[model samples]
Target: MNETIGNIKSRRSIRAFKQEQIKDEELQLILEAGLYAPSAHNQQSWHFTVIQNKEILDDLNESSKEAGKIFNDKYIQQLSNNEKFHTFYHAPTAVIISGKKDSLMPFADCAAATQNMLVAAQSIGIGSCWIGLVSLVFNGEKAKKYQDKLGIPEGYQPYHAVALGYKKVKSTKAFARKENTVNYIR
Candidate 1:
């Protein structure tokens, strides 16, 4: 099998992360991968906010969860009740992916870039998870503080985030892929 395909097959969402931070080189590569992701008309309207400081990380975990409280999601409500829950799953580093306002297909561009970063992280033995809960917090007035804290560019809105760090426990199994979801016209 091709190396890239093998990597794609082996990658899984790692929820538990070690305390150690990812190496600078690995972080650079991951960010580069996101930058290289194809964009609509090559507008490249995405911004990457890397948070490695423990204090800010903790703030993000708390604020995002607090922002999550207004949603009707049971899981989110449960997370609010559990003091142990960290939105980033205790990852030592987080990269927030935001899209520029007025950009064509900003969400799509961000999604592709985010997937690229996830694959790149996996290729380098780092664990990663795409987080949507945090985006919820960033969607309304609750976002102002984080916007300033993360230094999100004035015209950009954070669409998603990825938590990155070494895995506390490597996933030993891959779930079976769902079947009958594809169609062929030829």
Candidate 2:
């Protein structure tokens, strides 16, 4: 396989991370990679909140748990068993992806940016995973308060979040892709 293809194939959802913090310069590059992702009409409405403070992380995780209980009882039950699930495998840092709520493609634009960050992190030997559960937090009062604490302005909404740090393990196996999911017109 070609180098780019190989890199894409190797990227995996890294759930476990080392306790060490990522360097600022490397994190900046990862964010820059996300900023370069394509947007609808070139609006670039996405906003990224890079969080590293332990106290704030814990608070967000707790608030998320409370919100999950209100929105998804099943998820709350699962989290009851694994507390770390509250913050995406306890990764040291998280990038909360938010976008203008009025935008027609807010989620899509934020998702593309998040994917770019994930691939860039992988290329640089940093582990990253898309944390959809965090996005669910936007539906409740407590979560809304947390969002405000994160400085996600009144007109913007959280769509996705990604956990980033160094990986605890590596895997070579590829996930089986679903067949017949795509069609090409030529």
All candidates' lDDT scores?
A: 0.90, 0.84
Off by over 4 Å in 1: none
lDDT of 2 by residue, 48-125 (tens): 999998888777777666666566477565774565565667788999999998887988999999999998998899
Q: Deviation in angstroms for 25 in model 2?
A: 1.3
Residue-level error in angstroms, candidate 1, position 4: 0.7
lDDT of 2 at 164: 92
TM-score of each: 0.95, 0.91
Worst 10 residues of 2 by lDDT: 75-84
Residue pairs with backbone overlap in model 2:
none
Q: Native-vs-model 1 lDDT?
A: 0.90
What does candidate 1 score in Cα RMSD to the true structure?
1.2
Off by over 4 Å in 2: 72-77
